[model samples]
Target: MIDDSRTRVLARPFPPRRCQALFALVAIAFLAAPAAAAVHPGQAELVREVARDTGKDPAALDALLDRAQKQQSILDAIGRPAEAKPWSAYRPIFLTEQRIDDGIDFYRAHRALLEQVGRRYGVEPAYIVAILGVETSYGRVTGRYKVLDALVTLAFYYPPRAAFFREQLKTLLELPADHLAGPLDTLTGSYAGAQGWGQFMPSSIRDFGVDADGDGRIDLQGSLPDILSSVANYFARHGWQAGGPVAARAQPDAAARPIEAKDARPQWPLEQLEAWGYAPLQPFNPGEPAGLQTLAGANGPEYWFTFGNFYVITRYNRSPLYAMAVHQLAQAIEAGAGPADPAP
Candidate 1:
């Protein structure tokens, strides 16, 4: 759970986006960007937008923007996403033995709560644990940047996703108290400005966050029930299938049709992929909906059949590598945790 009891909340501006930890901070030649030393020219426009959408005082909202700093580190980090790595490299990062073991331990430690939430949401307990495991290392390292600073920097300074981050910033401000991880200024997670154990952005918190503790608020960082249930709700709402296959290794022969790496959304039947020469190592219903993914593995080219549930995992962070990592980690945790235990 996120312990923000000692966190000092500061005022920050509002707008929109979704976030998860998808990058590592890397040194960049252009790290010396100017700080948002004063209110950005766009801050006024943002304030107007927020005020119009949230009914907050314009002067108060503008004051929050004044406090939000533009951090150069965020710029550097966003410029170098870990998704740029091949699957062989990315897999090792999240699928480490230590991470898998840690996921199992987390599930066992919170078995009753995790299982209870799983039953309530029709999501597997292990999947919930896997998401927390991958997103923030079982809540051990959410991030270091103040969310306000990260979003402010990205929204005003970064051009590529400025429009998206600007909207995220506004959504953060407009979020109800119940949807926040903690005090506005104290919120922090990932270079992308996500918050809490699951690394959710403002819009995710608003739309998908769950008030699991019956405390009238959703605190993803400090409340395991909130974090676990929120993650499960996100999957369920996005069409997660209970007890369905997640992913499997596939064997593509020399005569296999060449396929390009693209979006992991399932678009073909198993029959189509079979005709294309991609065969799963594990038998699957030939009529099953599946997506084909090709990745560079240590042993050479690796093929995978990702089901609807796997695609749902990608909705959280849209990388096939990320989804596969979560699926494998969840499987490992399920095996380690043994049979399901009754909720205490």
Candidate 2:
């Protein structure tokens, strides 16, 4: 049992980053209650909705709630903000020599599966490899929180975003009861509770999971084929255009006018971006839609003219650094620009 006293203690002296402390509060809420109790009104309605859609029984979902609540402490530990620090803080952890080496081996081991998914979905194998490399160090560490706990805590207790988590909760209860990683294994992850190799949310799993190995069930926790397939499926669903450019080094025309800052969609027209002082490394027709995302670099600033495909990568995680890391890692892995290591 976790020291409930520690729950009152912050993980660090620093203020919480990314609202991570909320995860701790969420954990406590689930832990304080019976996981198998009748669902909250919102959850009860959601369960009915899921049951109606999937043709599953609401009664069948009670076990999932219990399982979710059981993993609360583990979720609290992993969901703290330390792991989700900013790029300056996060970069050192992932871009290590060992990680780079393992990335190579991961590419080799899952070469066929990754390549196949890339071909089918138009997402590059290198990008997929990079994603896995960053997410779990090529599956070296998936997590220590039971996905059930993380989901339930966020689903029922985190009211700021209860509706979203509740939907994911509904998806979880309706999935095969046997889909858990193991009875004893508690899968760990970010405060938002994304799970498995790709760090997919339950809704995403339900919507995008695929059986790359031709298996009857989609399993992201244990199967490389399923994980790769699921990642590709997610990219495709987000409008990843095959053989299309993801991003490019661009030079904005000094004379170019800036586009009005609005709630811009990733699918915003590339031509429109070009009109706003951005020019690509190479010449291309202005018919494409792109966005200008600026990030902090080693020196001052780095800018990217991102196409629709690049936007699709952002769908994995909203952060520009996350997307850039995946993109750069893919390029490095494909070029074999770094040392190799054994696959995990």
Candidate 3:
């Protein structure tokens, strides 16, 4: 999940004639600028590729690119994602009492739908709620950036992941016209171009979004059923084993090797980890794959035996901290605590 503070712009409605005059001036300014002055280097190639893929006219695609502005803030935010923070820092941000309470309310409000979807998709209700809670705070903060602007800015201006964002941009462009809420350019989402309660990227939405209410449309922004079911569906598709363990607390052996780089995926058998001087507080299948993760806690270090389900959670976001936050938050909400209550 990409997190950033929202920005609000207030504008008084303009008279029709004044609006027309303002638009005319802006159009003139754009026309007078040299093409290179507005278009990012390689943007033309992106436009051509999108046009070829989507059967859109290249000039029209170029014009759309011309309208997209480079957002330095997006670049800045992407540079230091929450995953980069230490576990002690990142956990508190998402595991706050307020978020946990909000998650409970969200779950209670949509209990039936969540249960139905969870049963159908073989995912737990708490996990579904936790994913939404972490991603957008139960839709309270779905972001404020126009998705077109964010995608274009990253697709052209951010070289590190330009190819990936460009593909996302292409996916956005190819969305079925009827699947969207409004004009493509006006759609708003996170700086990373993740949309709706689940904060799904364009490709994810296309692959997993469902019309759960059967209203002949999939509206993630306004439809709780669609949003909840879509999240469950994503987990199911990503190989979330039904009724499986997610994680367990572990005591490190005196000779336990210190964890360096933590891999979210379960890569070693429980037997192997046991041999390495780490043991789970709860028994798990000895043959099952597992990974050891060490987190920097306020006191010192915290270790966890992450299971396959934990890896599935990481597929949503590749951070062990993120999965832990979601797991812990889900547990807290399941305990029926309010924001004022301490986590379980």
Candidate 4:
């Protein structure tokens, strides 16, 4: 909740660091309260569209949407995602000693179950655990905003991604009531309206979510099997190759052809990359397809050959930095798991 006093600060300009907070305060004052309480006037079409698509009562859906509160903080968070940071800064956020230790502990505790899910889906257990550790700190913190609020605010008010979020909001409404965490008004998730330990958006839930426990429900919040399995399933569906390499640090020769990856997808064969002057430290199959990623490291530029599995991780979140963080964190956790951890 934003403080009323903070809203009064609009009388003066906020410093650069405080600018986001200032925007949040002003927006919240106008967005969350009496005037902005109802669904945005523009959302009348969305309610009708969702009702038509889902075969639900239009009046019911409209009344349900009335409960949503527009959140300005969500807009603020989206505008400045951490992925915008340089790789040097981004790496430290997820690669800290504490997170690594905790990841090891979390993995060891759920080793058997995670391994089972991994083998079933052909996705690595460490990576699955890493997703949880990175997305929500092993479910310690999911976002506080109502899923309804987050999606609706973005769908109706945030113009840049309004169409996309409107679809997410529609997908959410179309899902059977049982699929939700609870009532639409109460369901909570990330600022993007992604739900569960995996932080899946509504469409991801509809598409890749697994009811691994076979209890007739997909409970990503409370069911470890569901969370871990759904994540692994998403990876598998996105083309994670079983037992395939994810990424490897490379030593680029001084004359290494400056290669820039437009995306994480593998676009070069290992042999071709070597011929072009970027040499991976480890020996990989010469014919293996890979992509080169150069990161601005603390020491200098760091080169890495990201393979198909790495690209699969990137599908979960489009940022290559996010995929790299998950990759390195998974590696660190695997190394620290010690004698207790068995091979996947």
Q: Could you give candidate 4's per-residue lDDT for residues 81-108 as a string of tens digits? A: 9999999999999988988999999998
Q: How many clashes show up per model?
A: 14, 14, 0, 0
lDDT of 3 by residue, 37-117 (tens): 437677777777777878888877777778888899999999999999888899889999889889888877777777789
Per-residue error for 238 in candidate 1, Å, reads: 0.4
lDDT values, one for every candidate: 0.87, 0.68, 0.85, 0.89
For each candidate, what TM-score against the reference?
A: 0.87, 0.72, 0.85, 0.87
The count of residue-pair clashes in candidate 1 stands at 14
Candidate 4: lDDT of 131?
A: 95
Clashes of 3: 0
Given candidate 1, what's the lDDT at residue 10? 32
Candidate 1 residue-wise lDDT, 1-344, digit = tens = 99765564433322232112212222232365564334775887888888998899988887777888888889999888888889889989999889988988898899889989999999999999999999899999999999989899999999999999998998998998778867788888888899999999989998899999999999999998899999999999999989998888888888999877578878899989999998788778899988888888888988888889999999999888889889988988899989766569
True lDDT of residue 246, candidate 2: 71
Which portions of model 4 show Cα errors greater than 4 Å?
1-38, 339-344
Give per-residue lDDT, candidate 1, residue 78: 89
Tell me the lDDT of candidate 2. Answer: 0.68
Itemize residue pairs with steric clashes in candidate 4.
none
Query: In angstroms, how far off is 337's CA in candidate 2?
Result: 6.6
